[model samples]
Target: MLICQLSDLHIRPAGQRYQGVADSNRMLGDAVRHVQALDVRPDLVVLTGDLVDHGHPDEYAYARELLAALTIPYLVMPGNHDDRDRLRAAFADHAYLPATGPLHYCIDTYPVRLVALDSTVPGQHHGALDAAGLSWLKATLAQDTVKPTIVMLHHPPFVSGIPYMDAYRFLDAAPLAEVVGAFRNIEAVLCGHVHRPMFRRWAGTVVCACPSTTTEIALRLAPDAKPASFMGPPACMLHRWDPAEGLVSHISYIGDFEGPYDFY
Candidate 1:
């Protein structure tokens, strides 16, 4: 199964727009075009979150326009910048979107079972999976372990060793980890919202955090610097799942570029 993962567009509504420092809309546009031009069309597109710069109704409205350009099916979850109610009202017809009011969802299609969980904590930069979400996750994992599963969410369940980000990361990973530990079929835990691609392990499964299609978080691997935002190139992830090979995540830069040199 081929999966296209894009996150952290951080778009704003047309009228209530903000500065174009990130030129997020353009980056997202490039991503859409790239996906459309893919040699092998992806079976699914999973957007992990922060769909807007602010969780305004207008912002959601604008976000609605951009995502509608995708030729394949996609699902989005809430992030620190999203308002659950506003997101639902915007994408009322999305099939994989949950009806439970929170922006969490899942799907079993083709050779992969994709689960998108909500880790957003209202009005906060950090993330969490509450009791209800944890229960739902456990049930989902139980029903299908034989099938290759790729769980999607917006927060990293582990520390990236970046001090500021670690502070505002997923606070409760124990429960999630406990359940993840039990399911070996979980090929990967795909996420975003960190705005920089990061990798880690959770309960024996690989966790891949896709970079943002908007601005990126500056690498402050330091212990004292405040969270820094950068003008680094926007990016996304392309995931390929083969029964024999499991899963592989690849990062793609979507804007203008110039490179072909081999470091190897």
Candidate 2:
């Protein structure tokens, strides 16, 4: 199965730009078109988080229109920038989302089961998996220990070397680790929030944090490095799964570029 992951769209209202520079709406639309034109279309598309710049109704309205261009089915979770009520309401057609509560859910679409966990802390930039979220995850994973499962969340469970982003990393990883460590069927913990693509091995599983579809966060690893972003090549991650090969990810950059010339 081919699963495409798009994160941190940061969509804003029409005529608005993210951070007064990046045209978030246009970037997101371009990313969607890129996927649509792929030779091997993704069976499913997962938008990790940051679907909007602010948790505004108008922002969601615009996002809804932008995502409508997608040909494949898509799933979304909340990020620190999102409002739970507004997100749930915007995508109300998705019955998996709870009418009221954390927007955690389980998808049984393909050979792999998708477990989406909400890691957002309202009104805060940092992330955490509260007791309720942990409980839900444990129960959900226990149901099919042998089935290949992928856990999707907005906050990555491990710290990235980027100091600015690490400061707001997920806080309750110890408890989360214990739960994930016990399940070998969980192939990967897919996430986004750092606005940079990253991969890490944790608790016998892989953790992949996808890059933003708009701008990218600079990869400054210094202890005192300041937070900064740049308008680079927007991209998304495509995860291919097989019973023998497990899961593999490939970065698909958005927009036209130089050709893949022969290397004679």
Candidate 3:
């Protein structure tokens, strides 16, 4: 099974730009087209939060319009910038989402099982998994131990070296780590809060953070580095899963570039 992960879209209302600079809406459309044109179409696509610049219904409407171009199945979760109720109302047709509550659910119909967690803290920028969420996760994981599972959440559970980004990092992650670490069947933990692509070995598995489809946060490691972002090449994460070999991931950049030159 091939899973395409698109993160941090930050889509704005039609004709508007994100942060009054990045043409996030257009970029998201391009990213969607890029995924559609993939030689080996992905079996599913997951959007890891920040679906809009603000929690406005107009933004969500435009976002839904932009995403309607996708022909493949997709799932979405809320981020710090999103309003849970508004998001839930926007994607009301997606039955996997609960009628009212944290947008957490498990999809087991495919070869790989997907357990998505809601890590967003409403009206705040930091992330946390409350006791109830952790309990739900523990119970969910206990259901099937044999299936190769992928855990999805908006915030990356580990501290990224970038000081500025780490400021809003996942809080109360110790319990989450303990719960996930106990599950040996989990293939990976996928996240998106950080705009740049990142990977780390965590909780007896791997955490893969997908790059943004729009602006990318500057990779500054200094303790006092000022927060900054750039219009770096947008990209997505392609996770290919095989029962025999497990899951392999790659970064699929969005844009037209010179490539495919024969090396003969």
Candidate 4:
């Protein structure tokens, strides 16, 4: 199965720009078009959150319209910037979304079971999964030990070298890691709050954090690296799972690029 992971769209109201410069909506539209034009389209697309800038009704409405260009099916979870009620109401037609509580659930239609967890803490920039959320995750993973499972959420359970983002990393990650570590069938933990493409080996699984379809977080490594963002190439992560290969992830930059011409 091939799954495309897109994150941190940060869509704003139509004709508006995020941070006064980045055209998030246009970038997302380009991303959608790029995904649609892929030689081999993904079977499913998992949007790991920050779908809008303000989580306003207008933003969500415009975001929905932009994403509607996608011919392939997609699923979305919320991020710190999103408002739960507005997000759920925006995607209400999607049956996978739970009617109440956190926007957490499972997608079992494909060969791999996507277990989406809500890690956003209301009214906060940081992330956490409460006891009830962790319990739900544990129970869900225990449901089918033999099935290949991927845990999807908005926050990275582990800290990235980027100090600014690390401060806002998932606060209760230990408990979530504990549950994931105990599960053998867990293939990977996919997430996207960092706004950059990153991967780490954790909890006996690969934790893959996807890049944004809008601007990217600057790759600063020093202890006091300034907090900032840059308009690097927009991109998404493509995850392909096979029985023999397990799971392999590749970064796919949006828009056109130099040709894949044959080597002379």
Best by TM-score: 3
Candidate 3 residue runs with Cα over 4 Å from true position:
none
TM-score of each: 0.93, 0.98, 0.99, 0.98
- Candidate 3: tens digits of C-alpha lDDT, residues 92-189: 99999999889999999999999999999888899999899999999999999889999999999888999988888897788999999998999999
CA-lDDT, candidates in order: 0.83, 0.92, 0.94, 0.92
- lDDT: worst 10-residue window of model 2: 255-264
Model 2, residue 241: distance off in Å is 0.4
Better of 1 and 4 by lDDT: 4
Q: What does candidate 1's lDDT look like per residue over 153-252, in tens digits?
A: 8889999878888888888899999988898899999888788999987789999999988778888887787877887577778999888888988987
Model 4 ranges off by over 4 Å: none
Ten-residue segment with the worst summed lDDT in candidate 4? Answer: 255-264
Supply the global lDDT for candidate 1: 0.83
* Candidate 4 global TM-score: 0.98
Better of 3 and 4 by TM-score: 3
Predictions ranked by lDDT, top down? 3, 2, 4, 1
Instruction: Write the number of the candidate with greater TM-score, choosing between 1 and 4.
Output: 4
Model 1 poorest ten-residue lDDT run: 13-22
Report the lDDT of model 2 for residue 216: 90
